[model samples]
Target chain A: MSVTGAGRPRLATKKRPGDTAREEILDASAELFTTRGYTNTSTRMIADAVGLRQASLYHHFSNKDDILDSLLSGTVDEPLAVGQGIQGVEESAVVKMYAMAWFDADQLSRSRWNLGALYLLPELRTDRFGSFRESRFTLMNLYATIAGGVVQELESDVSAGTEELPFRLVETIVNGRADTENGRGSAGLHHASLIATAAVRVLGFPGDIDGIHDRAVRVVADVTASSIFEKKAGHGQ
Target chain B: MSVTGAGRPRLATKKRPGDTAREEILDASAELFTTRGYTNTSTRMIADAVGLRQASLYHHFSNKDDILDSLLSGTVDEPLAVGQGIQGVEESAVVKMYAMAWFDADQLSRSRWNLGALYLLPELRTDRFGSFRESRFTLMNLYATIAGGVVQELESDVSAGTEELPFRLVETIVNGRADTENGRGSAGLHHASLIATAAVRVLGFPGDIDGIHDRAVRVVADVTASSIFEKKAGHGQ
Candidate 1:
């Protein structure tokens, strides 16, 4: 790609691991943005980190907003697709819910940078990120629908409040990850599993959770092996 | 009290509703920080918004961070004290959980500005806000304690995942409030009540929720009436 200036002369500095120069810039941006704060990270710093010229970086992305949008989109799209796939499957609501939360939480927990922490950026409330917000809204709706099914199976008014809690519950992984990253606390490696079970539990799913967890694990693995999750090594490589 | 610059001549501009000049500055800062963003807002803009000279503004706060720290502290203290008070009272785990959440959600919901939205400000990661972060940490621990009690009352493995979730669930009001403010989706006026109920339900509280709600409502009102919450009428008033 011309943006990467592939087959061009080398800048010859410390290079980051990425299949392409664009990916390298994204990887650098992710580290700097999350660690240094998004408002504080600059395009020049990203270029320096990736050993690319600023002109070369601009060719791939128009501005810092583009890089942020691309990184944020990569985080949401796979989970939305995986959740949608789990929805049509001939599985119980518990499995569908658990699978969705588990897969979503796993990806958020495993992302190279805790980009999920950026969801609350005041900048995101603007029209520029309408699509990201909508995708997230769709994801929330999917969670509510699956949670609604779980509530129906119980035939009780357990989670009679907002069905949005399941989605909200899974997102705590974002906060937990941020806390751990900040050295405030350690949310053990099992946080994804813990948060997944808690997501359904908040919906009052009072059945064999271990069974649901087992099935969900398989569901997540199937989706991960599919072409969807393997969509590149992903943004931050 | 000197922060108010008492007996000083008034400036002719738009005035915010506050009993004191210090509170007025905080009120304006909360609005600017949450809406325009902490990083983007300058003290000069805040001074202009509140009709104060930049030099006079410095008398009350050293910098933007000082104003931010004061605004952030106001939101956390009342909830922490109320939760602590609830712990000492003879109440069921459900009652305690619901009451703590309802009171917290109410304040977070009713705040003049969505200051809770600023919690994720990347600037907060610094050690300069350590006391504020420590206070928040204490409040979270209190939530976990109340949530743990609810988990124990069930005597089931429902919320074995994380006691931290009940606090996390209540905090979603922050995100929900932001969403509603942005005109994305209306979370409803009853979001505080709904989220408080869900916060407990997440811990598997399965009996007589209406009764718990009734008691919790009364408890929250008592705390609101107390001199503790009435302390200075809060910042961003």
Candidate 2:
């Protein structure tokens, strides 16, 4: 709601001379895209928000599609990279899954996440977003892989329901919050841990639920708070 | 995408004299509302799509808001009514939850559910849809009520995690499909069963997963296909 930058004229002011139009446009567009959805947001509105005339806005990008392309790459591509990073780690699959969910949640809590939610809108599913869709499914597949490991370790049969259930459970928990105005702030991390716990439970992990809950919370916090999940996970703290 | 009804212009020709203008208008609006979103969809475009001049469309609806209000009551109000009907039933809370998830999924699978999905659009979440929002939360609270019953029946300590997990889990599965152009058709019922199974599992239900899944499928089909989950379930089913 505070994103409109009210009363700030589109003219280049002397005091804020360092701000580039591209960055300003991106910032303004992100706010509108998250708060008002991609389709409802007009280029003129974005220009008006950033204090630029609609014609001047064309200097930076050809049209709205160009702006959306930039936003998609900027916001969505990183998490896919993070998912890929987690995939190459030497840690156990359960730990990798925890790290993925944890970091993914933290990244989603950031302001850029509003742009990511745009991927969910029906109108935005054009070929222009094909890579975003691919990356998203890749990320989901990573969760399924980690979850499948847990099912194997537990010796449970991979029934039709159980195969996709854990991934969907994790997705529901994470994506459910994507639409809220401001992300959960401090509670986002807690929700991430809770999602991890529920996800493991859905996989039929048989440890003590409370103990797993406590350990899972700490594991996600530690993993997301550090770069260890990306490199080799270092233990012995 | 067939929702556009591209070549099928609105006409009162002898061949289609039975089709009412109101129904055609609603159908066209629902298609545009779901695909292009409410804000992006204009009355002019809607009129054109329905083969009416922009001015003539006003005879049926004063504005887009009136059209949206009718769409809400037509498509979304039924689910709310179904939820209310379920609330008055005498079946077990767990059973009610399954029945709710099942019928809700079935209703969502109907083509009209696309209009229901438009409620998720940020632009559409205005004062006009306040009743829709209230009805939505009331339906969610029904799920919460049922989940709470499972928690109490099992005497498990209710933590923050389990409190809303079941409702969200069911929502993730059901609402997740709302964006699909065609409801899963025959596969939709299977997905509904899977959603019911997962929702109950989230509540820590101890029954056989497959058995519960089968029963949930049958219960939902019966409730949705017939009116049994209401009047008949008012006794004991």
Candidate 3:
């Protein structure tokens, strides 16, 4: 049975005892990994923290590294899917674009501090989850598509390629200076939200959807458009 | 006499034979503190890394925490001086503004990865050397002065307060989604460079600067102006 069974309390599953124990183990592991780094944390610590014997903990997971992988994937994988879903939608391109960033930021803030530390670990860097290159690329592509749709919607003749758009848009939003050191709340979140709102408005999106997604889309589009145009003009000089 | 002078190639003057050794210990400690976090690193490891006995290492710095403070102060204090120096400059406000950010980025990048890790440590959050809050606030004040100068140069009737101008300008530049995690390059360095350039241009200074800064300024100015106007218009809504 899955960790979260339908209509059942999360910890109170009717599945095999092993499955229930595994879920408990993962839950405890996630908290520890998030607070203490993966390397500093030990299997014995995890087992003790979860009120299980060290050997019992071993029975649920192979080792500390396995727990690390499971914890990270569980948090990020769903967010990635949500981002993908937004990309798939053909609604107002601006709406789709804002949704992707909002969801990503929300998910990242929820787990990024611990997960970000994991990325920095030497062991994880070489492991399967080390390279976030694929996830980044996918998200960037979605941003570019959304940006292009906005440009088209604005009725501008500018056909800036997708490759260029994501770099310009995402760079303005995700650069680390805007985020807290541990990747919690910081100027980055507020800036992206505002920029996204401005971008949609500038792209001729109706002001009806004044929610977070709409506001963020408008801000991002406006700032991005202005920045790109100015850059192009400066090159001419 | 000075810390750097302690590690000299020639004997210069007949100093204590162990003077060079003391300097070597500090130097090694600094490198370790930059790379390995304070809690993760131990005095014995640092001493061993420097090819010295732990007792010899203790003779230079009192403990691990003391070494961390020394490393952090050495790394960050000079940048703070540069920040102060630019603030004191009698040059055009735009020049002063640009120089502040330019120097900050240049110095911060000299040891960015280490400095970034230093900022991430929780203990440092309360410690003066560890907290970036003061330094960042000081820098913001400088940016605000520059932004105010730009308003005056433009002869715009809109009178923005010093506090508001910095927050607005920084918010516009650093707050975007592209500037956060999942964004490319270092956030602080990229934004600082971009803002330094933009502050100069937006202040209506003669635009002989490089293309990137020039473009960024123009774009940022336009967005800031539009956002302000929009906000005023929507104040009642």
Per-prediction TM-score, chain A only? 0.89, 0.69, 0.57
- On a 0 to 1 DockQ scale, where is model 1? 0.47
Candidate 1's residue-wise lDDT over A1-237, tens digit each?
224554244486548766678778888998887777788888999988988778777778899999999888878887887887788777878888889988888888888888877787788888998888888788878888998888787664663555677787777777777666556664642367777777676667756678888998887777667775467334323
CA lDDT, every model vs. true structure: 0.77, 0.59, 0.48
Q: RMSD to native for every prediction?
A: 3.0, 7.1, 12.7
DockQ per model, Cα: 0.47, 0.35, 0.09
Docking class of 3: incorrect
What C-alpha lDDT does candidate 1 achieve relative to the native structure? 0.77
For all predicted structures, in order, the TM-scores are 0.91, 0.76, 0.57
For residues B118-140, write the lDDT of model 3, one tens digit per residue: 43344554544434456545545
| Clashing residue pairs found in predicted model 2 | A10-A51
**Model 2: how far is B40 from its true place, Å?**
3.4
TM-score of 1: 0.91
Task: Tell me the tens digit of each residue's lDDT in model 3 across A1-237.
Answer: 554322223333332223456666676676565456554678888766656667666666777877767665554455455545555545666676666555444444444233534433334433365444455445555566676776676563332232133233323332233235533233433344443343343234443445746554544444434544344322210
What tens digits encode model 2's per-residue C-alpha lDDT throughout A68-158?
A: 7777666545555565665665665566655666555555554443554465566555676566556555655666677777778777653
Residue A237, candidate 2: alpha-carbon lDDT: 8
- Model 2: per-residue Cα lDDT over B1-237, one tens digit each: 112223234343322111556666777887787777777789998877777667667877889988887776655455556666665656666777777776665555544435545544565456776665565566666667777877777675545656566656655543455423332222322366666666666666656666555655555554544564354323110
lDDT of 1 by residue, B1-237 (tens): 223564245565448867677888898999888888787899999988988888888888899999999989888887887788788778888899999998888888888888877776677888998899888889988988888888888774753546777777778778777777666564743367877877776677766678888999887777667775567344322
Local distance difference test, candidate 2: 0.59
Candidate 3: residue B225 Cα off by (Å):
34
Residue A68 local lDDT, model 1: 91
